[model samples]
Target: MKKHQWMATLLSLICTGLGMFYIGTPGMIIGGMLLMALQGAALFIFFMTLGYLGLIIGPLAIGIHIIGLIIPVLYFSYRSPRKPMFDEKRRRQLSSPWKIVVRTIIGLALFAGSIYAGYTWGSAPFMKTAAEKREVQEAAESYLEQKYNEPFKVTDVDYTWAIGSYNLTAHPEKAPELEFTLSSNDASPPAISNDTYLNQLWGQQLRDRLKPLLDELYPDQAFGEAYVFAGSDTVERDYSRLANNADGDVSQNVRLIVFADLTADNLAQEKERVLELIRRLPSVTVPGETDLTIDYYAADLKTPESVKKVEQDIDDMKGKTSTYSFRVFDISDITSADDIEIRGLE
Candidate 1:
């Protein structure tokens, strides 16, 4: 077929470098194929990285499209190819404008199909369809109602790629903050992303018990963050869900992290007090192996950022930056207390 200029221009306009395909010259054909390969690679990378590569790939793809747009315009107007598009034998095919339009339509349809295929392959694993989302929501709702005896609504299902699970946001009908953070793999019951449910099972009671013991010891400073861990096991997400009955969370093995402020003068005394509190933990919760750490920080550097600055300042200040103020410690797997290690006191 004798390729027309307008058909070449139209194809390039919509399908990018595809116009070069119609130009029927060796250089143009090869250039069009190269552009096609580049565009395909860009699209695949964009999908695999979850669209993180869009900033770079987007501009490169558009630049290729612009080249496709200009190729036909420049060639037809300037005789830039300087060669006939088709030989006598090749020109025997259809030259009808209707047939040309039909060919263009077919090319466009194929291009669109390729795009849809790429999207399905790249994103389907990372997102849930409407029916799948609803299924996750229903599973979470049923699990919560049966376990907690409270009406819970599934608000949203977010696919967390890092953990490889679809985390469903389920909240009590009354309070949005009480999220159950239920997650599902579609093959089985959903796991919890947080401990709101476990708090009811035992975490809350433990928290309530720990607070009073710390109050008696320091009587003023509040706890920072608290965790109840099972003996030598660290998996926390599978604990209390009715469908998962994982007994790791039900174990009495626990650890406590406390923050305190003290100077060289009272460091030893405070350590003994914290150890006494750990000894008293048996009265409040079930007995099992435990780890207790008192993070001693300078009293004045209470904010996390400030304490972090001082912790890092030792390279320049030779450990003097937090000598008078700060917290202690990360003692683990213990019957606990601290030994006197006060320096720079004199």
Candidate 2:
């Protein structure tokens, strides 16, 4: 039986290398199996990674699909099937309108089925219902409380499919800002890390403690968002971040991004104000090894976009944050603002 290239290509269009069955040559059958296997592997990975692996697997699957669509165009050695497909003896008589219509319906059904499978199996795992989210939240809360022997609250449960776990934002009853991230996927045990919780805890405390100091020094709100972070030592030793430690390098270290506005009008005045602030920073009791990114903007030029990203928005600024921002200036990682020596300015 002569193979129909159009029939094979159309079948393969619905599924990669599906047309090979119609052609039925040994080489075609082998190629079809390999391409089909590749498609299956891609599907498995897409499910396992919860769709993140799609980008990595897309090209390979697409390449196979493309090949399946176009490969029928090239001439191949045609062979008869072991059991004659469609009963070649009755080919002419069964070429009636009803037979043709039935075949068309079957083809359409196949195409539709492929699409349905793609949606149902591929997406169903990642999408959870509200009840499922609530269940996960309860489970995570229970796990955290038992693990730490402390009362905790689960604010929300969110499934991050990229990592295949439900990420829970939770906090101890006493301190909400000192929140911890816990993950669960129901199959394995709920995972919680003390290291992550402690780091977040210390960072929150440092930020809170620094705010009052800023209020006293720069009373007119001269400073902006101060991302105060503690080093690994603070996380490990579990030191109270709020405690005043004059120790040079113990636990507290700030891998910090802070915004300090230049108060003066002219450039010279701005330099002087910045220098003064730099001199005063040492006295401010920021102990341990500290690195600072002090983004400087003009006091007058401070927009919601301009200063600290979103400390103040004079333009009816309540929630107009998350807008695109250009850097007013980039003085990042200046450990000692006093140690800065600009050749031209100096």
> lDDT by residue for model 2 over 22-141, one digit each (tens)?
455456556766666666667766775776777887887799789877775563333457746634632333345564455445444544565456556666667777877777777777
Clashing pairs in 2: none
Write down the lDDT of every candidate, Cα atoms only. Answer: 0.57, 0.53
Task: Give one digit per residue, the lDDT tens place, for model 1 in 1-346.
Answer: 5677787887898786667766655566667666665666667677889888899989988987888889877866763235556444334344456765655565555556556666777776676678867777787788778766778898888776656777766678866644445567655455544424553334445655667776787654435223444432233333333123433333443333233456557667865765676568666654433444334444554456544543333122233333332233332233545432333322
How many residue pairs clash in each candidate at the backbone level?
Answer: 12, 0
**Model 1 residue 303 distance off true place after TM-score fit, in angstroms:** 6.0
- lDDT value, candidate 2, whole model: 0.53
TM-score of 2: 0.47
Worst 10 residues of 1 by lDDT: 310-319
The TM-score of predicted model 1 comes to 0.50
Worst lDDT run of 10 residues, candidate 2, spans: 321-330
Segments of candidate 2 deviating more than 4 angstroms: 1-38, 42-63, 71-140, 143-169, 172-179, 182-191, 195-202, 208-241, 244-271, 278-287, 296-338, 341-346
